[model samples]
Target: MTTPGEGWKTPELRAAEAQVDARFKQAQDLANRLRDTPLPPVPPVDFAAIARQVERAAQERDAPEQLKALKRKVDAGEFTWEDVVSGKAAQDPDVQAMQQENVNKMKQAFQMLREGMAADEIMAAQDPRRHRDDGDENPPDVFTEDKW
Candidate 1:
């Protein structure tokens, strides 16, 4: 009733082959699903915006170093909530100095803009993480892009 190699397979051998076929079919189905799956899109980075945010945070953290008089007064608790609430705190010499620094920085920025440079260009100039071209060789802004 059997033909060639089919006559040599015992019932146990036939059962094993059936199990192998079932597993192979399952594996193929899984591989097909994986091949058809779509990957998520990658988000683009705004390095200039990130640089601006970090610079702002650094300015706040550097207050103690920039405003020595302000730090001393703040540590001594000389100014009360009432002084701040009544707007007297704005008249402080240290606060005025800080305002002047901000004004000077803004002036320099405006001058750069008047020279036809973009805001992002100014930010990039100030960003230490940026790499520059030496006029002879072209380079990527971010050093991590060397592989490109």
Candidate 2:
């Protein structure tokens, strides 16, 4: 090993430095060649035309599949054109039942509100924690003044 203050002029170091200098010269020559070469001009793109072509191709590919699905639904008696036009095709029986249940619950809630029941009373009545068995004749009064 060389001393800290010694110049780095050992034979091995000189050989390494020469190799690096040769590599640098080669890289510079490549850069010069690249700079001297002429590049081809880029043509302008028509994005709208490309988008239209893609949309047309997609429509062509998807049309038969969509028609087949519609035909299957019609054959199964699951849909009609009148249902589609009336926006009722989306509402199946399960969806209708759920909507009706919700409406009934809302009506009951409104009736309770009109009868001067507090919101907390309504919520407490609906709370799972307060659930009782059908055999229990009298459910506990959630609105009792002493409970609070």
Candidate 3:
């Protein structure tokens, strides 16, 4: 719509101006398309996963032989955490002796209990001298001369 001069233009000039205007409009359309179109999305980054990968790579680099040996054993089914076993545990003689003593005491107690049940007496009539049925409350202590 804007002209450079006030004078009337010839046919070729007008045609040339129209061609230039069309090309300018085409260029503007291309510019608009480029501005309006969306760009491709960028993928999300996983820093933690990257860090773990780096750590594993470093460990493998540092101990390649050990890792390979372990892998070989695993692949051949020669080793397993469940299959690992402990040797016979060492027993202390003192502890074994104590256990035997306790076992003997328990056996004696059970025998005494069985005898009491057969005789209808819960106790073996608790040694007569150890517990007296006398009505005396206080008994005199006969101390030695040194204790006195």
How well does each candidate superpose onto the true structure, as a TM-score?
0.37, 0.31, 0.25
lDDT (C-alpha, whole model) for all candidates:
0.63, 0.58, 0.50
Instruction: Give the clashing pairs for model 1.
Output: none
Candidate 1, after superposition: displacement of residue 88 in Å?
Answer: 3.2
Give every collision pair in model 2. none
Sort by TM-score, best first.
Answer: 1, 2, 3
Model 3, 1-148: lDDT tens per residue? 4468835878778889889999999999999999999999999765556545533533553333434443344346664312221111114332244346546756766787876653324233332232444543223353455445
Better of 1 and 2 by TM-score: 1
Best by TM-score: 1
Ordered list by lDDT, greatest first: 1, 2, 3
Question: What TM-score would candidate 3 get against the native?
Answer: 0.25
Evaluate residue 143 in candidate 3 and report its C-alpha lDDT on the 0 to 100 scale: 45
Candidate 2 residues 1-148, lDDT tens each? 3457658588889778789999999999999999999999998765556545533533443333433444456457786534433446546653344346557767877888999998877766655344454433333553445445
C-alpha positional error of residue 142 in candidate 2 after TM-score superposition, expressed in Å: 55
The deviation in Å at residue 138 for candidate 1 is 27
Using lDDT as the measure, which candidate wins?
Answer: 1
